[model samples]
Target: MAQLRYQSRRFWGGLVGVALVLGGSGCQPQQTSTETSPSPTASPQPGQTDPEPPVANPELAVYWVAYKDQEQLVLEPTKLPLDNLENATSEEQLVVAFKRLLEGPANTDKTNAIPEKTQLNSLKLQEDGIRIDLSREFTTGGGTKSMQARLGQVVYTASSLNPKEAIWISIDGEPLEVLSGDGLIVSQPMTRKEFDDNFSL
Candidate 1:
């Protein structure tokens, strides 16, 4: 009976040892996987934006008409910092210069041609010349002397772009044949030479 009891205890002890070994082997990490985690890519910093390419500003000349001795109207060259002049087309450059003329004068010695209320209705570059259309207010007031000065202003300002071409002036959309303040009959296309011959100081 003593031997049988000792034999049973030994058999139970061996079974318990085998079960523990099998459980431990099942829990061990596998060596068949050879895959590795991928590395992370670079990202922009928080709240930061990409830098923009550099741009350049170009210099352009805008013509302004003003009285020299309070008697004669003279053409004054105003330098403009045209930011997009380099990349602009020929017509676009002319438009920019014309727009600058409409900005009024920065020089206290210089004066503008069109009335303060006058608006630039349209601007077009034609094969013949540059046609400029202004609001009807452009012909509202001013004496003959003022009208001539204003006319000279438009001629000279536009001439800076073409230098040797003519400029056709229009009021609202119709050709301007008669000027205000004076009943001067203006030709269809006014040339810089005409302004130089009659109005230059």
Candidate 2:
């Protein structure tokens, strides 16, 4: 197998973060942190346990869908650590951060004309990759090219943090046959180059 390394950063609260999801129903919100390499540092005080960072609060994020000038995947009752807002380290926390950013303006690219809001409907860790399910609002209000750019933004942004080969994008919990006319179907393993090229990372 060829060994390759790919990196990405998603902006939240004016900072870049690891793996930023573009749209969904209940994902977490965040800013990006500017670090090519992530160093495992101790989370201070309350965030610190003897072993590791505290687990995410239960039901901390709720599912919501938003539409209007800007569509959204909303997550109510968002829960995450307060001090270091960028770079969520765990899978559960990453999920929550995605939801929050989707609802907020993390991935909203007005210059590119992609609706800035997204949410996390469902996320599961399957094998070596993370399965992220998205809502219909993700593909709203745009031409084919516009939507494609947006999809690229979402895919590369999230995959940058997770670095998973297989990405299954679903519409309202069902897999999409083709995203923006690209052969971006579910259950296919994406190489780092494929992901970066397709999503413009």
Candidate 3:
């Protein structure tokens, strides 16, 4: 009976010790872990444009073309204008570019006759080709080696900037003969070898 009484006393002592530890003033509540918020995404840097290039220029972008008959610069009717042409800064750039082409060299020598004053009435960029209607001046005389090259130079210059398949040359509403003694058309790209093989001078 005395042994049983001692065992009971030890069990009660352990329970009291556990209770005291749990109720201690120094003990604190468990803390919860929180995930930190990710930093905000960054914006694209300048000059790093999207892989797909924009066909028509941006809202504020400027573009220029040549038109001699008209005193001032003008945009090609075929080109899309997000806004009014008058407001575009390219209006001035067109004048400067056209003037430069007029003075530029086509070759030299007996072929050195200056190109006639021609106006670009219309330029249609089609899936298969580009249709260009010129002024009456584009016709007339002036058929020589250098004069023809000058014609090619002008057509090549415009097509290069916009990047199109063929450039069909026309006058009034008809497809005009290329006037070159050799049958070379400006509706598409022309290589130096092709010019040599076809043209005499």
Best by TM-score: 1
Q: Candidate order by TM-score, highest to lowest?
A: 1, 2, 3
Give candidate 1's TM-score: 0.64
lDDT digits (tens) for residues 1-201 of candidate 1: 999999999999999998999879986787787766644443446896756569543335676677677876777878656575767776677677777777888878887866788878888888998899988888878778768777877776676656777899999999999887457778879898876666534
Q: Cα deviation of 201 in candidate 1 (Å)?
A: 6.1
How well does model 2 score by local distance difference test? Answer: 0.50
Lowest lDDT 10-residue stretch of candidate 3? 57-66
Best model per lDDT:
1
Taking all chains together, the TM-score of candidate 3 against the true structure is: 0.38
Q: Which stretches of model 1 miss by more than 4 angstroms? A: 1-60, 69-71
Clashing pairs in model 1? none
Candidate 3's displacement at residue 17, Å, is 87
Q: Which ten residues in a row have the lowest lDDT in candidate 1?
A: 35-44
- What tens-digit string does per-residue lDDT give for candidate 2 at 1-201? 122222222224324332243333236576597766534663446766556657543322322223334653222222345456445445565566566546544333323333555557787656756567777767677655555455554454445444444555666877666655444443354534564455431
lDDT of each: 0.76, 0.50, 0.48
